[model samples]
Target chain A: MNSFQLEVNIMQIKVLYFARIKEAVNYSSEDVDLPEDIETITALKHWLSKRGEVWANLFSGKLVVRAAINHNLVDDLATFEDGDEVAFFPPVTGG
Target chain B: MIRVQTDDFDMAQVLDDLRKHNPKVGAIVSFVGLVRDINDSAEVTTLTLEHYPEMTQKALQAIVDQAKQRWDIIDAVVIHRVGTLLPTDQIVLVAISSAHRQAAFSACEFVMDYLKTQAPFWKKETNSQGARWVEAKASDDEAQARWTQ
Candidate 1:
């Protein structure tokens, strides 16, 4: 394949959910195609908020939300590329 | 090390594994968290736990690493079970091995505190009335936040 075709075929993003967030979203993870400029965690949150009301409520207000990119905690400025695992959930209560 | 699995683990087996070949290990502290039969006012019969696989393991490892950095712990293990579990069943196990009891105890508690407020797991309880997802407890968060400062 040519370089242009290769670029077009690249997978862009993946969003993973845990606990109640998974149930609310009705998915464990999903691959998404996003524009190149959409790289930060905050931008991804805004894009996902458009998916439905559940997304809006889950991401809305002053809820304490935690996120990880490629299995590491990241701030809103964290960047991602194709095939990176991005996860979101409310504050955890494991123990 | 950390493990996230659906199957229950043997407490004796884990303890033995922690002390098997290590002679310098003078202390081993463990915390076993069981599925409770009550939540708030509800009578809970069972609980279903869910977690983000990659993130859960990574977050756990990070917590363990932090404990090692802050203490003199020789080894640590954290095992959290997912899926449906009955009351009194073990849901999580944290073990810390160190040359001193203080490090062992403190590290074990630190890991639990971090897990309670930072690790990505949720609990849903089912009883005769209905099934409900447990909400985050403010007290638990407060318990964890105190350690940060």
Candidate 2:
């Protein structure tokens, strides 16, 4: 008898939406699982845009939204690991 | 010290606590921002402020730390208010205490300038024309850039 093992790579990340982004998405936060292919922020955004019409429109590169990873502002090219918290929102307008 | 709260702050009490043990401070400069009845050609009756809790605190602390590093100030305090606010309500306050008038004035202005742009707070205005989010001004960015250069 022969036995084989299959390996899989998955990453679970906490995603937060704030301000206008939250209002648009109608969600505050959720945990999402992404495949290994979605490693970077840009890839993740592209992947998330496929969720539905609202997601597609919001992440379609028209909105001037910003992103933060682990509570720190980061560029779209930033990469993430499992269990990281990512946030998206509009430009800050406070003092 | 830094604080982000929905409750209104007392400037006199805050100043008293800030200068309680600091006998070296000679000058205290402060700035208070308030909600206005009119903005951008609209009548603003109520303004609701929103923020990212963790990020907002971190950003405020970082701003104060930068001011401390740049100026020889004895101490500083930043109190920002969130939630629904009516016209004439206090929105933010920045106070800097220093040994001289110059440092206190400059640092206070510097902190306010940075806070306007760097902080992660957003304001939505409810006006006669309905509610809308306030846009970031280029003038604010320019004011902040002057410090970097």
Candidate 3:
């Protein structure tokens, strides 16, 4: 539990895309190692938008996408932890 | 009970089973949602429901748990079918049982309202033109808003 040991622990998370977002991104789920600066869902989304065109379009507020942390719906400001499952999708349309 | 499956559920069998061996069950109110042949003036041939498998069942249970806490309900059942469905096919059923009609009626509607806006299921419509994702209607948000007020 020293500073050097803590620095060796990389933050990893599983990101999921559903429906149209999945289609656009061409990936249903992905594992990403978090950058030290990206601690919140909003920051993660902004970082994801830097990937390329389709990703930028999906994550840059162009398409309305809802997010969930570990299968529970959450706002963009929700903080992320290591090994969490974060999901993004459009509004739900079920009855 | 919450069942998220692709199999079509039989209304009569489901209803009949809910009241069995439970003498206090004096009333049952259920709502069934079916696939529509038309939506937004388009000829919708088929509807596909996609859901987060790990989330759908748990979210449904949470919804019913909320409904039960608010009302004096004996039991509740929620069945939401996923995958591709043809027009006129059954999609969802929300049944609530109680000793009185009022609680049954109110809880049934409450579950359906919450499920529409809160659950993770998404729908896509296929037609002669093409396939497109169904947009979440503002009307649905309005419908759920009524309950909170």
Candidate 4:
């Protein structure tokens, strides 16, 4: 493959958190590269779970979490591509 | 309509905006959520509300759409404020206008319920003890789920 093709093959994914999750993660968002097979939301969480204690603690077990892919609520099987913005948070409490 | 603004709103002006176009409107139900001075037994001095801008507007618009489907309402408006706010300050407002009172009331409550559980907004309260983030309540999900069935 050409160098340009190889560069295009690599994808960037961003994970954002809010409230307690943000505090626990110590970051509002982070960018990471994923293997070609790890394109779904569930797989992404599994990948993030191995990052460290903070991620494992927040994502491990049956924690109540919500996710949005590119600004829309999505199911666990949602797919991602290069430069897709993903967000994670606990249930909302507004109004 | 859904608006996320930092400036405070005038209730009379908003009411007039909703009622001026329709003479058949008989009931107008409105809910104003205030930033309280206390949370989780802590005395809150200031509160900051944060939201994902694009997603927040879309989610609120979806909730308003659902309310429109379930009720025969003439108009609905959702106004939410962000940034630093003090106690007793209005944080959010939901207004519904309909030909009858029950649809207006139910729609207003329904919109608020969906907003509480589905919309993306986080709040942090600062007090003498420092700052504490509010946790998401399980009861909120139950509240929104009731409308599905």
* Predicted structure with the largest TM-score when compared to the true one: 3
Query: Using DockQ as the measure, which candidate wins?
Result: 3
- Model 3 ranges with Cα > 4 A deviation: A1-9
Alpha carbon lDDT of residue B37, candidate 2?
Answer: 86
Using lDDT as the measure, which candidate wins?
3
Considering just chain B, what TM-score does every model have? 0.97, 0.97, 0.97, 0.96
Summarize candidate 3's per-residue lDDT along B10-108 as a digit string, tens digits.
988878888998999999999999999987537899899999998888889988999989999999999999999998999999999899999999999
- Chain B TM, cand. 3: 0.97
Candidate 1 Cα lDDT to native: 0.85
Model 1 residue B52 CA deviation in Å? 1.4
- Tell me the tens digit of each residue's lDDT in model 2 across B11-42: 99988987789899888999999999887537
What shift in Å separates residue B133 of candidate 2 from its native position after superposition?
1.3
Residue-by-residue lDDT tens digits, candidate 4, A39-89? 888888888889898888777646767789988888788897878999988
Model 3 C-alpha lDDT versus the unseen true structure: 0.91
- By DockQ, the better pick of 3 and 4 is 3
Which of 2 and 3 is the better model by DockQ? 3
When summed lDDT is taken over every stretch of 10 residues in candidate 1 chain B, the lowest stretch is B35-44
TM-score (all chains, Cα) for each model: 0.86, 0.91, 0.94, 0.90
2 versus 4: better DockQ goes to: 2
lDDT of each: 0.85, 0.88, 0.91, 0.86
Ranked by TM-score from best down, the candidates are 3, 2, 4, 1
